[model samples]
Target: MKKIICLVIAYGLVFTPLSILFSCTVEAKIVSASSVLSRQQAIDFVKKAQKNQWTLTEKDYFSLSKVKSTMNPYFTSAYINEFVNVGGKNTKSGWISNLRDTDDVTGYLPYDTPGKEMTVSYSKDKKKIYVTGYANSEGDIYKVTTTLVKTKVGWRIEAIKWL
Candidate 1:
């Protein structure tokens, strides 16, 4: 009886973690978007950000607080902490700080500043979106990959990579 109980407990410990891990993986795979992020929307979002009104405008940004609220639990704890707790110019340093200072979430681009127009693309899985900005005074075409995650409220920008 003791050996049988020990075996049952061991199996339970092993299977429980496997079950939880598998469930998380299945949910993570549901990131594909039904309504893809369009070029026009990206243009508008960029425009608003360049004008330094993305946070100000009622129609564009959902507000920093709203954005914070909509963030996914999957995001890194350090990223979330910095994102939520960033402060003035002296101490603030991180993606969140950059996100705050730059008008565009993908970092300030020439397209947004010069209004040069840009292109947008999506991953095959539709889990990631990219916006490529035109040449600036520096003649640089900024390729930015902005990740938006689906949440209970809808979808929210979670991370950005400016290449």
Candidate 2:
């Protein structure tokens, strides 16, 4: 009788948690795999950023914020700390100082000023995007690529590379 009782108790204890674990329902929220933005929409987002507004619909904001956060700190910092001189004599030192001052606001300094032309391309899987453009200050073209993933908050950038 003792042996049987112990066996039953052990079986009960082991199966009880297993039953609960198997019975519990976990539902994964599903988003459309085909919900990525059209090519035009992506380009428009860049244009808006160039204007310094960085405006986006609520849905796009999540994705945009991810890209903004991952951008080379220097590139993003230029916009956040932008300053204009009205009449101050623009010496080489003044320009360098201004660039350094921008670091105070964004904790990074831009490699160059805003670019004139911008172009973007996205992978068919919608997991990667590449942007190439010219900067007004540096007079050199740049290519920035970002990787994205979908989350509960929507699409977000996972990484950024500047070339």
Candidate 3:
């Protein structure tokens, strides 16, 4: 029927553009994600990673423990041993500590109409820094929060939470 054809055409006109716009928005989020670290942050991160990597790779458990002591509480003392073992065995788990790979993905902001990626925020006392990263999606958004605290040794990740 002509009515059915017209209705189908109308729906096609409305939905086609809507779907196109939605897909473009999703692509934009991926493109806009912060995929690089600041120069200073990169330098600091690489320095720490290099020290830890060398110590761990050399099977220096004492040095590894000292380094991990500056980490967040979520990282129990047990993690240092696990890290040593993983690295010693030459497994992919060791890759997790590779500082060179720490780039823009380290920082992410939820995608939105405003398109702002909130990277780091300081606590009122300025002793704690919160880092948030997650997909900016309407459905099934998984967020990871990293909280770091300033310590005598330096700034250490105090906690990481998945929300």
Candidate 4:
């Protein structure tokens, strides 16, 4: 009986601190995962959302309806309509035209390329997130700021401001 009691105490001593340390490690991982996840989500959302800017041009039957429909999933309804322009007119106006002045090919955004770099910042309440990035090569530099709002479904972009 004494041997059984001693074995139980030995097992408790050997495993108790390891269990405590394991729990602490798990908690630390949880905190780290959440922080990293939010930042990555903001970046990924901007990359995916920005790629749809091509829908604003004429080749794809540039309809305000189509533009809104394509972007609505990523942006708020009130702001989705702001990006639409028929055939990318006005040269210096609208999002796509303002970036490259043409819709036939790639613009300055540099999707998934090495010349782009981005950073994330959050509002005090963490309800709003800003993903700021730049695409640069040679002598030209184009910067953009993408703002996102957390919603019931998930995060939706509020606006894409070029700077």
Candidate 5:
């Protein structure tokens, strides 16, 4: 009886971890399937972000906070922290800081363009998306690259750069 009990306990310990791991993997797959991030979704997010009132002037008070709050649905925390400045005298040294100092408020990300030619690529694990597109602004077309990361809430922009 003692040997039998020891054998059963040993088997339980080994199998319990394996079962938990498998279940977690299955749950992740289910979540991913339900929230599958597609190329169209990424493109649409960029367009939406472009329309957000992110341009702020030096005189604008707490504008960055408002933008960050408004953009919370579409951007990751890290991205917001890196790009959104809180306010004057306590600026986060982010992209919004530069925008606040710039005279051209219209010169923002995802510049208003007349046409569309966005390309999207997924990471090997499909947890990240890379978007490249052209934006027409100031009577010229420029290339822009953006990265989107998959999160529990949905897909959010990680980074964007002009190229």
Candidate 6:
């Protein structure tokens, strides 16, 4: 009787904490997956803006802000705004009225596409994610890496590097 009881207690001690640790790991993976999905949405939004199909609203603006702070602050706006075109006249008559507008330029390009094939890799700690893919329009491949931190508003991007 004593041997059986001691063995049962020993097994419980060994497996209980291991099960808890496994549960924690699974939860972390779910969080990481959610972050990846959000990042993908952000990329799609930029693509829509590139095609002049973007609907600028408070909600959309806030969603873009999520990935903006992670990018190089100096060029972040310009990089994303590459999708928008400001309409104006450049004539010999000292130019014309400047008007900001969103239109599909002759060589406009979409930022990201779903069927373009992408690879998302995340760190074991779930604090960093890297996305690499090719742009359908330019056929140019690019990689973006971002770090995330848990915040009251869920996961917030901390930094990003485009290469």
Per-candidate TM equals: 0.39, 0.35, 0.33, 0.57, 0.60, 0.31
The TM-score that candidate 1 achieves is: 0.39
Rank all candidate structures by their TM-score, best first, as comma-separated numbers: 5, 4, 1, 2, 3, 6
The CA lDDT of each predicted structure is 0.43, 0.38, 0.41, 0.57, 0.62, 0.37
**Candidate 2 positional error at 155, Å:** 3.1
Give the winner by TM-score: 5
Which digits, one per residue and each the tens of the lDDT, describe model 3 over residues 1-163?
Answer: 1122111212246436433221111222232112333435533443353344344223322344344553322233443445434433333333233323332222221222133343666677766667665543345556756565555545544454547
Model 1 steric clash pairs: none
Whole-model lDDT for model 3 versus the true structure? 0.41
Clashing pairs in 3: 35-104, 36-104, 111-136
Off by over 4 Å in 4: 1-37, 55-60, 85-116, 136-139
Q: What is the lDDT of residue 103 in candidate 4?
A: 27
Best-matching candidate per lDDT: 5
lDDT of 6: 0.37
Q: Which pairs clash in the backbone of model 2?
A: none
User: Following a full C-alpha superposition, what root-mean-square deviation does model 1 have from the true structure?
Assistant: 13.9
- Candidate 5, residue 161: how far the Cα is off, in Å: 1.5
Error (Å) of candidate 5 at residue 62 is 2.8
